[model samples]
Target: MRVKPLYFFTILLLFSSLNNAYAFCGFYVAKASSDLFNQSSQVVMVRDGSRNIVTMSSDFKGNVNEFAMVMPVPTVLKREQIHVTDNKIIEHLDSYSAPRLVEYFDENPCSPPVMYKMMPMAAPAMKSDSATVKKRARSLGVTIEAQYTVGEYDIMLLSAQQSGGLLTWLTEQGYKLPQGADAVVGSYLKQKMKFFVAKVNLKKFNQSGYTRLRPIQIAYDYSRFMLPIRLGTVNSQGQQELFIYALSRQGRIETTNYRTVKLPSEIEIPSYIKTQNKFADFYRDMFRTQVKKQNNKAVFLEYAWDMNWCDPCAADPLSNKELRELGVFWVNEASNKPQISQRRRPPQQGQNVYLSRLHVRYDRHNFPEDLLFQNTANRENFQGRYIIRHAWKGTEQCNAANQYFKSLTKRQNQRAKNLSNLTGWNINDIQKTMQIPQRSASSSNEDMWWKDLWSQ
Candidate 1:
């Protein structure tokens, strides 16, 4: 959907029931949608040295005739430099990087199972105007450098000498900008950036026989590695969600302007989070809580790993052909090697590509500046992973079992606290939901130490 005032960048279930009980291994119950937050957008950027390839996709629900896109770029894109890619790749990338809910059943304190099984379940256009708009555009120093029809989109490369003129020209031409958008546009104009504007070609769109818009991909060789998000914030739709997936030949990509903190992962949470189908709720609350904790100034790193493989994989790595489509020109297209599959080991070396997923909840106040990014040599693997350790269900009792039962209560209590801490939920409510009892001098028969040992 549109993440900005106008339509802007908007941008999967696997069943492998039984899996080896190992680190990062468990059944993925549910995943939270980026749509969980309002005004959300997704962008996939692939970088190698000075070459940058950016793909923009959105779920614009407006009339196809009204769909349009306006973005800033360091250089003008040529016909060859611009392309349209399948939207499925973006979805695959999202699934590969999304935060996951994993559940691990507790082995009986007395006897552990050798194996286990887990089941899995699953842009609008611009306005129109005539020659009078073009004359005004020229007087306003807004020049349309080039125009082409790429796929179902009618694209234009525009260079403007001033922001007010450009904004006026755009307005006359039917592209509406937010009240203060001229300031942001001026900033980009001062940087010698060009505006890449697009609208749907109704005839081409119909002839293409597609249901919706495919992501637009653009490649350019420029030294500035950054994203201009200020325009998106000018409209001020409260806070917006931006998920950026960066693919690089070197290593992890991180925001240089804002603190890039890894989201809390590998933490234990209450079991009911899965049983009650509240994984989405838990994730959304926890994310908001984390944003608050950071004063909403930090960019959260949700996933960072070699693109060649993933452990406790959310989804398979993009195939070579798919990677090429994303503008990873360095990959050997002729290689016959098999595409990376779901695996339980550390990422295999030699893919020469690493992916870093950065999430931000931003508004004009906390994030005044557009995102500035840098690629790092740090290839350490990371993912937003939460755990659910099911309590051992058994009747037989032994010395180990007795201790296990005692520790289990403490563990469950700690889980409740964790949920509270991560999500900002009330501790009492969390405990009540998890059935954690308060410690007291007067206890019920069920609380006695000998109760389970002596009884069947």
Candidate 2:
């Protein structure tokens, strides 16, 4: 109660400095604040540029005290998925194909059960913002082993008997394969399987027409990962040889590309590219090649916002010029341009005269001026069919569409004559077959399940 003013003031100053200390008393920065390191459990704490201000008592030390490094281990450094640019992602993605199918191998002549599965029905296609995921196939199950991109080189083994019998299985499952298609599928499978068995027996068949490959297991091999690795086939000699791709040190199941061309099975790939650099340059060149404007090729471009403000809607037109350019004629509209209509004027009261002297005149006006018509001459139509996308107000529009398609078969016949050799096919049938289903004109939206049945 009787303390001096100076003594009290000094004590207050000391307490204030203690409470306002910058951080923990010691200057050594913390290595880690918690147990989680590379695992999904992420740790984020305050750091002053150089180090974290993490504090721990002596009791908090154990296996849970795993220190997190700034960067990941060298092995897992490769990003699990690839990084693509904005423009390249959208443009190039559409052009990619699943490299090939998966392969199945056997040991002791089918003693080991051969797991043969296909991915045609694995899952709905992948949907992404930058690109459309056409998932030629999908991994049915997940394990510690992750899946790889479809187009890589890999091998498989199957019982010759099983592969041969699969033709019958395709029929029982209600797949309607054309005679020519069945022949191609069968022959391809048989040849591959035959080479496999031939190598196992070490029987040297005619190596003249045959590309001689000394049978040896590839040291670097990739995993199947549930992809539809090209199902290989056996030959008449009951033998098969498969080319396997080992996963890279970076964990990617990669294949030397077409330019760098590697085949999982004994496929007679025609040589086009000469060197590995040529192979690496192949895709980049391809990306450049596609951007080049080809007068012959016409694509069905779907713009997101222009068609309708709806999310991810395809732009369909009463008449799309691109389709017409490809010789796909859209039934012409009634008139290319709209015209002003003439109307009758109101009759004047108590005005009577001879027929020639009548005061009635036609009241007509030109079409309304709008931005749509602002661009060009009135004789021609608008540059685009600008409207709310999919604006089918009534069944009348749908009925018109139905009627147009009803005669589409007949048009393809006449068009087949005029279609010329532009598409490289003699007729639309081949192109129809070539189309990657669901994108075809004849592809039905009403019942795709039935169409899927027919497609098989």
The candidate that wins on TM-score is: 1
Model 1 compared with the native: what TM-score?
0.84
Q: Which candidate should be chosen as best, given lDDT against the real structure?
A: 1
- Predictions in order: lDDT: 0.71, 0.18
Q: Write the per-residue lDDT of candidate 2 for residues 60-147, one digit (tens) a residue.
A: 1222112111110001111221111122211111111111112222222212244432211111011111112112111211111111
Model 1 over residues 51-94: C-alpha lDDT tens digits?
Answer: 77888766555556766677666566789988998988887888
Model 2 TM-score relative to the real fold: 0.15
In order of appearance, the predictions have TM-scores of 0.84, 0.15
For model 2, the stretches where C-alpha displacement exceeds 4 angstroms are 1-165, 178-181, 187-247, 250-257, 260-456
